[model samples]
Target: MAALIVAAGRGLRAGGDLPKQYRALAGRPVLAQALTPFLADAAIDHVMVVIGPGDNARYAHAVADLPTGKLLSPAQGGATRQDSVRLGLQALAATGFDGIVLVHDAARPFVTAALMRRTVDALQSEIAAIPALPVTDTIKRLGSDGRVAETPPRDTLVSVQTPQGFHFKALLAAHEAAVAAGLSGFTDDAALMEWAGHPVKTFPGDPANVKLTHPQDFDRSQGAPLHVRVATGYDVHAFGDGDHVWLGGTRIAHDRGVVAHSDGDVALHALTDALLGALTEGDIGTHFPPSDPQWKDAASAQFLAFAAERVRQRGGRIDFLDLTIVCEAPKIGPHREAIRAAIAAAAAIRIDQVAIKATTSERMGFTGRGEGLAALATATIRLPEPE
Candidate 1:
């Protein structure tokens, strides 16, 4: 079966140059997060994305790290949500897959493997299948005055989500008919099929597979409380006049630099935060204190390698890392790629798995005064669930 992911929404509600699907949630793009399970499944043949016209660059930036062998080029989306869905259906029509087609929203990133498999099963028995959860709250209709008009029966109400599956041909025909009839009020594909006289089956939905509509949604992540850990490190060196400064793994030619016990790589220091977070260890300072004198001038890479080896020894794997560098003088853009490479190399992971970014304190703090560079990082690791 094939899948078409509708990620074309401008995400006006999420409010950013980056759409909601492209937003970072748990250190990964929301769209890439949604696509992972489908790509890993053996039954899925290919996947396509419906995106805004002239935003191929945005799509490219969002999916740069994903293996593109299974991805189709972005199909041009329309002004309305329905238009985007219709366009996605049209694109898949050309691929000529007679098997079932799964339509999913790029904004929903928490879909699970079991739910995805069940969606496919529903398609085998019914022309269209949707995943939904019975509404739990007592929903009420509100009038212009902002008072409840009437209470809707909760038992009959359900909240729906995508990866909505269908017999490939039937879905295509329904979309074509909807467009031809000028009936565009339908908010989802299942509704369109219903209006076209097609019966859509329903399956259970994981509450965690939420659609990210605003920034706050990211702050509330659900699922197995990802084995979370935090580590902090601190390095202080005397100020000295020098031509080169190293922060997080980026090098800048400057007039003065922090004299350190090692390279004074602030980027690595922040990465240690995430690594520690994953390992549930303390910060960099806890592991390597300045009073020890043994680590003076130690290469921060040594600290990172040691941490990684320790994590492996404990039977865990690092999934991704987010590192941010803060400094005053030497701009960061020129060295971003190099910094990414350095972290990935130290972690023994792909460069794409490491995100390196830079920011300034707006000259407000010590870093703003150009005293020294600072970094903050968050890391994710996966360990076997307890037996």
Candidate 2:
């Protein structure tokens, strides 16, 4: 079966510089997190992501490390979520895909492998199957005057989630019919299928698979109490013969470059170590040893990304990162924003959450003598209390 991740929506309600799907959650883009399980699953043959117009570059960066063979080139999506889903289906149809398709939202990064399996398993007997959790709280119907008009039976109500499983051809046809009939605001794919006279069955949904809709939803404290950790890192590189240096994943012209096994990005290296320290994981060298030939002249961004992923694997979120670069050459003021953006992208956090500053060593130390550069970084992260 193929999986289509709907990531086209702007998600203004989530309130970030980037769309919610592209926004970072636990040191990785929400879209990346949503795609990981599907890409890793042996049962899923192909995976496609539907994205908003002009988001190709951002999408590419988000999935940079993923296996390219399983991914289809991103399809541009329309103004609405429904439109995006229909367009994705058409794209899949054009590729001669006619098997089962699972539709999911990129904002629900917590969707698990087990939930996906349950949805797929249900399709064995039904044309459409979705996961839903029984409504536990009493629901009330409101009147025009704002008073509760009726109390609905909670036992019959359920909160639905995706990846919703469906026979590809049937779902594609249902979407086409809706467009032809001018149906505009049906929220989910299952609702459209129901409108097309197909029976939709519900399997158990995971409560942990929460959709990120509002700004507060991104706040770990808003959902559950968490434990916060802070760690600091410092790194320095001596001047070498090269004409330029790599700093925070960006190349800057300088009289001399740093001598190191990797790209020698002092800022990124420090940030990576800080993240590892916060996670109680060993330093960067512990994971990517300098003795390994594969890491020779490697970009420091990869080191930072590795550390960030470790934090996510432990179910933690990076709350803030601050780095100060000490250098005598190649002033950092002009590139401060670029460095912040680069670090944020690498660490999978918001740009606002990262801070970059520059300083001099008062002409006393190696940095002041124009011999090399140094960087100090502090990382703050939050994780769920240990069970």
The per-model lDDT (C-alpha) reads 0.75, 0.88
Prediction 2 global C-alpha lDDT:
0.88
Evaluated at residue 194, the lDDT of candidate 1 is: 93
Clashes by residue pair, model 2: none
Q: 341-370 in candidate 1: lDDT tens per residue? A: 666656545577777777889998787777
Q: Least lDDT summed over 10 consecutive residues: which range in candidate 1?
A: 229-238
What's the residue-level lDDT of 337 in candidate 2?
80
Quickly count the clashes in candidate 1: 15
